[model samples]
Target: MRTVPGRLRPRSLRTRLVLIATVLATAAVLVCQATGLTLMRSWLVGQVDDRLTDFRPPEPVYRDIADGTAPAHRPPPHETLPSDFRVYFYDADGRLLPASLGSGRGEPHLAEDITARDPADGRPATVPARDGGGSWRVVADSGPDGMRAVVALPLDSVEEATSKLLWFSLAIGAFAAGGVMLLGGAAVRLGLRPLTRVEHTARSITSGRLEQNVAGTSPDTEVGRLGIAFNTMLDQLRAALHRKDRTERRLRRFMADAGHELRTPLTSLQGFAELLLDDPDMSPARRREAHELIAQNADRMSRLVDSLFLLAKLGDAPTTEHGPVDLLSLAADGIAASAARHPDRRIALAPLGAGYGADPAELDVVEASGDPHQLAQVLANLLDNACTHTPPGTRLQVRVGSLRAGPRTGGTDRPGRTSTGPPLPAGTPAQVIEVADDGPGLTPEEAQQVFDRFYRVPPAPDALRDSGSGLGLAIASTIAEAHGGRLELDTAPGAGCTFRLLLPASGGT
Candidate 1:
């Protein structure tokens, strides 16, 4: 098993998927924004340049230049020009010259001022800059005399209009991008509609639903592959469940058969015993012989049938109530009873290490929560097994106590312990009852299979006859599980064996 680390948690599926999509979308937005901004700026600059290039002087200004009656150095003037562009003229030098409006080619704003300037054109000329942040287009030319002409326009208006258009484009682009994302998400979700149905179907059949499957026709699509995988998993689970069900049924049938086979002899013994008791003239020797045979067979049948019945019940009929059951007392009673059956054999209980066996403190009475009938059944099987296998004088020990699980089981105690306790609650308390014997025990491998129904391990070649119907340990194991507990074994060949039953403790929710 792999351990899970919480401090360094693994990333979630949803977070990973959402992050991938967000990153891709963000990259697309950056690419689009860059492309649009570059193109808009270039286009606006071209339009401004073309508007300035198209400005030209009127016909009167040319006429004046051809007639040679205008100022000697002044170029033909414009009658009108657009607000975006400007033109200026100079006498072969880069100078700020005067504008001659309407007496020449292009139109200008101040006509009277241009006419008032002297014929001599020797001073630097300037256009009053608009908004103090404007650019002027200057065009210079010589006129009819020693005169000059110029044009000036503010750049503020052209730039302001361009800025407004760019801002509007930005707002529209942002809104469109957001809308596209929403629409894209909706389209993706809509296109995968079949997946939702597939998910619901998968959830419905976690176990034993062999007939349920996704009947997907579009195997080429991604969603179709998912459906195929889901159906495949269901098939495997259904097969496993079927196998388990068959195995359980077979076990139950074995127990039922053994119970009937043993009951016949038991009924005969009881009937004969009653008849001998009622006889008025029978000799004492004859009566005692019949009585002993009847008693021996009766005891054997009782133990065998009881074990079979317990196994049968465990397979199909478990009572729900987990009430009080003194498991310790049950084991002691079984030991005393088994000893009485074999008077020739000496079966004894080992003191629980306190030496003072008569004192309450010296005794360990494990008061666990479970069905008394079931616990007694378990105790009898284990105790009987100890007596049958070991030497006549070997000691039998039963211990009942609470078990504390480690971190893996949440340290909570389960009330019953045979081998596996209830999954250790994180903080739950659990109980365990152990039946140990000094008799020659089973090997590890044999012990493991002993709890399986009808699994009879052959005894040593020189050993005595087998006494059990091969269902005793199996029944004991079943009773343990009925209380949400497990039965575990500790022993090897020639070594003593201990069977432990672990369960949930009292006050466990």
Candidate 2:
């Protein structure tokens, strides 16, 4: 186990695998040893039983020369008996015969359950010798006429052999099992070596080293595939962390910017109110002017606060008020309204198509799905931005078309119309609305940051700077994005900028 700052871990993979292998090997060895010992003991017992059942008496004991009865069958010689076997003889009246009759045992040693007429039938019976010797297996058989005989063998030899076999088997099995355990442990350790490398890499990652990765193994192996997956997950985690950090930094900057914007208006209002309050003899016109000024700044502060809150809400959830909105009509109305707001600007509407559309008043109907209010607000922002930035009498046009081609490239096509880029995928037409003006177009740097929140271009040396909150384009961009669309700027220095609003066409339009 390796120590991490606050984490206590378990045994390494190699150690766990070795322990598992050892347990398995021990189980296999035990099973084999138990089976072998059982079979060996049974075979040895059968051998001893065979010897007891096959024993035969000597020939003289079968003869009737010294007895009153004649022998029915002659038995084998004494020397033919097994070495550990002993025989017993009984007379016709069931009297014990002396050892001189060539019986091996000193006297009769049959158990009480066995009798002359009942001849044992070769079933083993434990017998105690009359001379008080060790246990014996005894069997009885009828001899010639009324004579009877019993055979007995001691148990010590059979027991000793079986015991020796058990010990030998145990000794061999123990040695074999030990050797197997050693080999199995080594094999397990070798097989899991790749996992060890992965563990080390994981440890490094846990300790804040996100860039570490396991490498150099074939992907075909299980461990190798795991390593690849682990590395991919690590990359995703690092990316997420980086994104979170960046978002936190942006939030801090946004807070500071918002405070500065609000503070300006509040200070202006406070200064004006304080002057009116301190001067008891202030003129009626002066008081009226101060009140107007305070009201103006107050309105500006309220707009900034509302925009900030809207931005925050947009980040959390999109507007749910949605329907099929005629984008062309919306842009037409926005242009007409801007014409009223800035009566000096020459604002007009047009239609773009493959034929270089002939009519501006009869523009093609282009529909998109979105909250109509939000969409209208987006249009207003674009028209207002153009009016405020451009010189008085600068000609501005709002072109509406079903874009077979997607968003426009940053170049002027005609006095009021700006051209678009290449065509979109077949059968999925998008709607494009371009707001173009002949005002001095933005520089490359300005174009890049125009959509960023609270960003405005530095004013030119001798030109009047427009009073703006700088969140107009940012809000429009956010709203467009929320509706699965985008707002793009196509501008370069000295070439008037075209802001293209691209939205997916609604169903049936």
Candidate 3:
């Protein structure tokens, strides 16, 4: 007993709409028929009353009675319709009365057995005649001379007219109801026109038209809003997909950069290593120098590769899954490691005004959340940037503190919209670590693009050429963002570059 939307037959919207309209139309017809029946009944009764009002006795009897004379023979009233209708009547005393104005009932009258003791004046009733073939209207009242009178007539004309009207009304009602149903169906289809466009757009998507977008212009009703909404949805999906594609391209470029970065040092290391292994006799000093050089190149290559791998891991990391890590210890350790690696070089610690402290230990373990290894990589990249750009005697600094990262990526500090420290925690605060150098640093243009993949500082005529892959800064920035923060660089011509790594503060989520 499993249910799945995939296995079920989806209902059609158009058919459903039409069905509802048809049912309503049927109801309308029934209502019209009932109304028509009632109205026609009233009209038929009026006709019967009209015929009854015209009921009058024979002319001779009427003349005799009108002149104040007694009638020799009394007769019933009748109408002559030129066809096969028998006119018969009864006197007030219940005896068969003759018709002086038309043909009498043929042979044995159909209404002969339905006689009633003189009916009350102004009172009338229809009685079913023999074999149920027809009916009789029996009415009684005083005559023109104060004499009693009774009238009986076959109801054939009234009945025939009633049957004709009933069928005519039903036909008219059915036709009107059918017209309404058809119009209703057209209206429903017209109303759902936007849906048809949505369907067309969806089909286009399925057929490899990634750029196809829903057109919302020129709608005449609420369907226009639907078109707009659908187009907006497509816009969002297209943006998401485009961002994904850009990420993939950047990844491929990063890998290629990493491989290229390693190749140069690896080539030197391999050549030196092979020389040391050769049987050719060499001086001890020369051999020692070759081995040391090879080891140094190998170390450089190893660090470069590790940095790139860390950047790649940022996107791959699961969101909100890693435990919190203290960024203070991480950055401090990285600075120390960079100093120790190049002991001959100079390093310094400086504080900034925004609550960032000067002491190396002053970089307290700020509670940040992320994969420890990736966070450590972010720290190492910052250190590497400081190391490469600084002169041997130039000062290097690292400062750690907290700041709010706003929901607006463009930058804002408004209340409720801003976050503290990092944008991680579904857009929250962060632990910011700034690493700076006093070496002749970046030009304004270079500072803006330094984090771009493959970008490099401009080479001066006599300056040292950049030997490492140009991806170090870019890789570091990628890692910073993957942790739900951004890398901001402060630099200008003649002013050293300062790099900031913002990581989400712990407890933010």
Candidate 4:
């Protein structure tokens, strides 16, 4: 496609609008002027023709011309023609008679062929004057003795009046066109001011000023709506950039933490293998101990790698195998496993509130729809996290029940916490599993990052050597989200930590 040259095409919207408006206005003015001029000329000529029709020469003048006795180049007695009118007579044989009458002004020389034309039945005709004075409007009629009488009126006055009006209309039209151009240009500029501001804002954003926004975003006009959409787009873009930045930061931290965790076990393995290899003559018992240490370190490294892989998988796509799972049963199994692992710790299944049965078997069943294996893993991680963090004697309880009311749905006062997952409406059915421990609780600052991957609270001096990896709660939180649920922590300084896993209930059991 061929494009118009920049100079020939209007570059700005304001200029185009002004140009179009001025053109239309000028065209309308020209049409009206032309119509007025034509009507004025027709009306003026009609008046002259009416005058010629109404006038009648004196009877004695016509009688003298018919008898061939009228004086040449002289007016007769009792002549009453207007000063602007001219009268002439023609013989019956179509020959010009010298006799004529006129005002004292110079006479117009009419053509002989025009004078000899047949009678006009009182209708007027326009003919050029041979004397070059101007044109004339003439009417011819038959006299009593078959002589032709012609009355001529000069058209200079009509032509002069119409010429003056034409010039006046042109002057007024030019003034009107200029006024329209100036006023229309200003109005168009005013109307497009918002667009100009939007363009400026877009440029600012392109230059990395994400905070810039278009002003005047009312929903009333086209420009206003455009500004509103532009602002909305900018806000979304800024948010996306922030999210991307956060993702990158988290990935870097994860990589650093993983490397640090792996390096510890790798150093231990390398040290023990060198010990066994260097001391070939050492006692058999020492060699066995060194080999066991090497195996343990190797196992630890394997677990860390597996946890990292699981996190990556969950992050990439959280899809899970869906199935019906009873949260109460899963909680029972998790408590049993934790008790077996730490025989000294008192881990037990308990009711969430006083409305439930006393017998564990008779407790209200809390059911949910999700991957049964994944849901079980979530329960196990929550229980393990509780058992590992608290002291051996600290009492830990697993509670399963259906939520009666929705939890709060806004950002917490705690710095590290985000908005409590999307609000579950009041009275909406949901399954909940909670792992509560009466141990040294976390502070607001600690609680914020407790769920972060590889984040672990500093262990007590008497804590066990196998404190386990810090990915349990983070993995549990991810699994809960994959199941269309959320993991929440309720704790404060000196208050026991309680991890709650809330999932939409499949149906009442």
- Model 1 Cα lDDT, one tens digit per residue, 1-509: 67676665665544444445655765676567657666765665555444543555554664554454555434434444454444444332333344333232233332223332442232322234433444433333345444455534444545676577667666665765566567655665676667876866867665544578887636788888888887787788778888799878976877676767677777879787777878857898988888888887777777676766666667687755668876667667866777686565554444333222344355566678788877776777777776666666666676655556543222332322124334444555666666676667777667666766666766544433655777777777777777776666766776677776667777642
**Order of the predicted models by TM-score, top scorer first:** 2, 4, 3, 1
Instruction: Flag the better candidate by TM-score, 1 or 2.
Output: 2
Model 4 Cα displacement at 66 (Å)? 11
List runs of model 4 lying over 4 Å from the truth: 1-10, 31-166, 186-231, 276-284, 322-325, 332-347, 350-362, 404-429, 460-464, 504-509
Each candidate: what lDDT? Answer: 0.60, 0.71, 0.63, 0.77
| Clash pairs for candidate 4 | none
Candidate 4 on 156-242: residue-level lDDT in tens? 889899989999989988998899999988888888999999999889888988899998788999999999999889889989999
Model 3, residue 295: displacement in angstroms?
4.0
Better of 3 and 4 by TM-score: 4
lDDT of prediction 4: 0.77
User: Which ranges in model 3 have alpha carbons more than 4 Å from their true place?
Assistant: 1-27, 42-128, 131-158, 174-222, 269-301, 318-335, 344-351, 354-373, 404-430, 453-472, 504-509
- lDDT of model 2, residue 95: 64
The TM-scores of all predictions, comma-separated, are: 0.44, 0.74, 0.63, 0.70
Candidate 3: TM-score?
0.63
lDDT of 2 by residue, 34-121 (tens): 7876887667666767887787664566564335353322234443444666666676677655432233444335643435556655
Question: Which portions of model 1 miss their true places by more than 4 Å?
Answer: 1-236, 239-307, 344-365, 406-428, 459-466
RMSD of each: 15.2, 6.7, 8.7, 6.0
